[model samples]
Target: MTYKGDVTVGGPADVHELTDLMISKVAVGPMDNNAYLLRCRATGEQLLIDAANDAATLLTLIGDDGIGAVLTTHRHGDHWQALAEVVAATGARTYAGREDAEGIPVATDAALDDGDTVRVGQVELTARHLVGHTPGSIALVYDDPHGHPHVFTGDCLFPGGVGNTFDDATAFARLIDDVETKIFGALPDETWVYPGHGKDTTLGAERPHLAEWRARGW
Candidate 1:
């Protein structure tokens, strides 16, 4: 339950006012897991990612925020435990992978697959499956208003570490490979990565660490 750093507040305006999207990060509960509020400036369309264990905090921050949907990265309790409450508060549809759909208490409004695109106002998010930490882990990829792509990695990839794996080691390795080749390699160097835990990092900063992590057999 350590608070690693201050909760970062950022958006399209924080970078450039001309950008049409805004993103805000709220660190909730003792775990300090980051929950992102992605808002489309043009239409006031919003998406909440990973409510974590603290429903009240998330609800308070998202009060009448006009959330359009809730996107979950995996089935971990610390990541999605507040999903039901958030959905009830916002009356927003929930999206998750079909494989982990049953684990979630509420009915999933949409079952996303790898490469599927989800549109929120002017934002288009491409779902990339990365099943190492859980059977249905995925990352959301989209082009920011600045035209630079960004990835919401959840627990799949952190600034200096990868997601915890209760599954087989070999399977986790494969997941790491998918993240490197498909996610990190696919995006531009300037692409921002918002992870479930820790500070935000760029693809350029994390790319060199991939080789070191792979060498360590993570």
Candidate 2:
């Protein structure tokens, strides 16, 4: 079915567009987790990232296109409250980082490793394992043919700093290093970041504050 109206934050919001792909975001559940739906404009195939709480809302977002796959960024309960329901409803394949797959309520059909690529129709999203928030926490990177990259950082990197490390100093360092090299170091300033919660931010806006995050040691 044709998706009516525009996408919004609490509803469905059009995040951005690649050559043949359109990214949409919807915030759901008590924690206000952001669930992202990436649709291939050419084929109508769709992929969802972080199918958090409120299965009804997610199902509505899934709509007639259905889903080709569901990629769980981490095993956090808040991130996958609707995982089993969505997978059961659509029969879509499931994928998650190898280290964290087992914790998920549903079995992962494929294991995601750093540098792995997941495809939705013709669009390809590269998985980057950014361990810290969770041992298998990951961020998916989508590179637009004509623009800077866009990343779905599950619970990893956010606008202010990396996701909470649960007071683990070692995990905090690991997250900081990966964000610096794999993210801030590799991509241009224009890269758009859609986090697990709250507003969207660009790498350019958060780049200068890296030092502050490091010094504060969060």
Q: If scored against the real structure, what TM-score would every candidate get?
A: 0.88, 0.94
Which ten residues in a row are the worst by lDDT in model 2? 1-10
- Residues 125-178 of candidate 1 have per-residue lDDT tens digits of 899988778888879998765678888898998888677765468867977888
Quote the lDDT for 111 in model 2: 95
The 0-to-1 C-alpha lDDT of every candidate, in the order given, reads 0.78, 0.88
Write model 2 residue lDDT over 43-114, tens digit each, in one string: 999999999888889889889879999999999999999999999999999999999998998999999999
- Please estimate how well model 2 matches the true structure, expressed as its whole-model Cα lDDT: 0.88
How many collisions per candidate? 0, 4
Off by over 4 Å in 2: 1-12
Candidate 1 least-lDDT 10 residues: 9-18
| Predicted model with the maximum TM-score | 2
TM-score of 1: 0.88
Clashing pairs in 1: none
TM-score, candidate 2, is: 0.94
lDDT of 2 at 33: 87
Best by lDDT: 2
